[model samples]
Target chain A: MIVGDLSRRELADRLAGEGLALQFGPFNLRIRSNLGSFASLAHQLYEPYPLPEPAAISDFHVDISAPRGLRRWLRRQACFGIDGQLPFAPYTIEHAFPALEWGINWCVATRAHHLLLLHSAAVERNGRAIVFPASPGDGKSTLCTALIHSGWRLLSDEFGIVRPEDGMLLPIPRLIPLKNQSIEVIRKFRPEAIIGPSFLETRKGTVAHVRPPVESIRRAQEPARPRWLVFPRWVAGAPFTLEAMPKSQAFLSVATNAFNYEVLDEIAFRLVTEMVRSCDAYSLVYSDLDDAVNALDKLSQASDG
Target chain B: MLVSPLADRLIWQEWDDIYIVYQPAAAATHVFNETTVLILKCLQQGPLSMEVLRHQTEAALGVSQDELAANDFEFATTRLEELGLVEFVDDPSTAQ
Candidate 1:
């Protein structure tokens, strides 16, 4: 049954007790939370996700709840726990949603070593993927949001999971978290974009999440051949420009941004080398969202020509 | 004296001017720029002494002898050793 099949109260009850099992691409996550706000948001935000069969084993068993101690009495705070160990300290209850989102990301980035995990935003068009490997605050999510809405399919906003055996980019179409001013920027740029509640004054300043387009979620199982490796940067007042990047530099950028490049060792090395060799790599700098998306569209079109 | 690359543990691939090396002994991957690729290629074709290695790499990369400083050669040798790619060996006759 899909997660939406559960009533809000039923979802809350299950989350407070056993957990809600949902699939994200190749991985299964069993999320347990007693926080009503988190549960309600999960119901809405994760509605597109499929509920795995009851007997399926979850790859990560995650929880976000109040710690049992003085903090719970002093000020209700939420802590993220994976398999009973808390990796992050508690934040105010209001930050529960972002905490949950980040907790899952941590689970994937830290554990998934067999696959080449890149810190990138990926989108697809015409069965080919364009990977944007960049550090946080490089405006990747904003660019990703614009592209997905402008006709491209979102593979992922935080991770570009490459299946090593086949060299295909797996789709993990989860919610894209928009931080600070980008939230308002995306909202004004695409008023139709569905944004979740904002959590103020956290570590990343004000933050909100935009739901993955329903089409992206619907096509989440489809893997795309990587055709372009573009490093995108959003510079203030800069005109849109795309420059061809040397494959050597592209290799370094990807190696540096990869989460498990070293852990995967030779497999990671060959995978990245082949990816750079296969793709038309570029470094893109742009200020206008429309221009950035157009530049990417042209790059995607280059695959045909 | 001939220097041999650590053949048992080291693996590498080249793309254009870039080469990525994987050393199973260290379970690490190292990327070499064009210049480093030239240096490594010289080392790969049987091991040569620091002097011979530097001369061959310079000839291959079009780098003049004066441009290739002693410290630069030492740095590359040390880096390759650290990556488990190359190592210095005493002359066989001298050892006997």
Candidate 2:
């Protein structure tokens, strides 16, 4: 029937069994999968917009009818609709939802406002927000999980959605995905934390999502002005260290990590420039999550003071 | 013929006092100052005739008539074009 009538789980099942039918913003996507590598396809379809472009338009639908043998063995399969023909065999909705999410984000971003998506997690404390931006495997998620458990509000784990107009971060703190060791690290750190199902042997080793704290989810609509930009690197045995970064260097580092910085062109530049200017930038390297959290707490206190 | 070859195929975006131009395929981003930012913004909506661009820039910046036509405006526009910050769209009817 109509999308409004079906629940997310029901829609997901329909897409997995018969085929998925849902509208993401302006684009209506329908996917059919056999439940094998369909999850992979869903991820691709829903992956965040790589570059800010108009919402993708796909009218001609594809029929991906896969044989049992192919379905059971396939790790991932994807083929676009060409001319009027469905390029390949059946694909499932599990793989398509993630792709739609990403595509919808891209479409909304490009049309409504330029978003500078950063590879960072943000949290709020006492009316001020702190952003932890670091490369993958830097223990950012681990630190973020610890802070949230300690009463800091989680803003996001994978993305830092910054509005180009005011440099305010839009808080859509969803599940914080933790990889391999970090998952165990967080598990040990916050015994009460509820972690999602782990997808073992996937591309990024053991991957599981840490559910956002209930408070964070409840305050998901609260946008925060960034007060600190800390680039964190997890060093196994090193003591906690915090160093101020030059604004120029911080500017370049942040721009390099920004998702839609280049796409937004001048607006992105100004927004980021203003953001970094208004916030304190630092390099935070630590081994222990407790120590890292302490140092951040001190930093935020000093900033507020 | 007066067009600086540098300004071709460039797209400029302005935010407040900052102006930035990014060449997508080239993966290059250049930042500009307030004056240049305003100049780029003047050309952003669509290509305007140089005369119209100059007047608009003057009005936006609140420059006097004499200072409006000064060498600074011409020099900045030339340098911006040289740096691949603006472009000329060929209109057959306007072509001399």
Candidate 3:
């Protein structure tokens, strides 16, 4: 069963009561929200993901609700809490869905110590994956979004969940939030893309999200062995340029860019060491999506040959 | 200065001129640049006076001793000392 199977009223009833349990890649997430806006958008966007069994255990239990008392009427806000703990402050009601999106990232970044989690984007092609570990505003999401839309499979848009036992990247294809100018860039680029409502003037300026392709959502359980590590940066008016990066330099960048590398320590060290040794690394600067995608395609194709 | 017992327990890998050493005592991985790598390699040969270590490091780097300041050698050794990876057996404060 999927979210789409449930009618609007049925989904609302479930959310208003217990929660809606859904499988997101490797984990089961049980989401509860009193905000009707969040439910509607969630239903529309998460339609492709499968529903978890009612008896199965959930990895995360989160809730988003409008606070009661004067604040509800004075200025509406949506609060995200997990297991009775509020991780961050409330978002204005208009940004309720975006709040839910960011809340999911917070949960994984803070928890999931069992996996070597990286602040990165992972995309796959022909069993080979490229992990782009980068800081925010470095065009990680933009490049990931473009690649996934341009025939590459979206392993993940935000979290690079690396299984420590083996260096394979576990797929956790979630929504890609395109901020400000990139929103129009993607909208014009991929008309067929399923996009959620734009939340304007929130924390990240005007923001919109592009849904993960249905195929990626359906094939969420499949993990890919990484073959490349590309750090992408968006440079306006600059031509597409890809330079080979040293494995040692790549190792340092990946270790520092990870969300919890120090917490995992030795295990993290071994995984990164092994991963960097096996994969080719590059630094990419680009302005145009078409040219960038072509260059990446050529890179993978050369490796395949 | 001689490498400490903790330094002997270091888990590390070298790629080209770069080396990343993980000190189990500090639970910290240190990434050493070329000069630090040269200094570490020189110290790995056994205990040496500051003058000897500096000469060996400069020789390996192919830079004349009179040209470059021995700052990197001082920096690397100072860092190694702070991390308990090395210790001064002869009180280098008195050394020129």
Better of 2 and 3 by lDDT: 3
Local distance difference test, candidate 1: 0.87
Q: What tens-digit string does per-residue lDDT give for candidate 3 at A168-202?
A: 99999888998988888888878888788889998
Per-prediction TM-score, please?
0.92, 0.60, 0.92
**Rank list by lDDT:** 1, 3, 2
Backbone clash numbers for all candidates listed: 1, 22, 0
Q: Write the per-residue lDDT of candidate 1 for residues B16-61, one digit (tens) a residue.
A: 6677777677877677766666777777667787678888988987
Best by lDDT: 1
Candidate 2: residue A143 Cα off by (Å): 1.3
Could you tell which candidate, 1 or 2, scores higher by lDDT? 1
DockQ of each: 0.55, 0.07, 0.54
Interface RMSD to the true structure, each candidate:
1.8, 6.4, 0.9
Q: Which stretch of 10 consecutive residues in model 3 chain B shows the poorest summed lDDT? A: B1-10
Tens-digit lDDT track for model 2 on A125-232? Answer: 987888887887888888998999987998877677887667888776655667888888888988898776565754456767676666776576678899898999
Over the stretch B7-96, how does candidate 2's per-residue lDDT look in tens digits? Answer: 335555554445555655455777676766677767766667766777778877888654675587778887777766665556555677
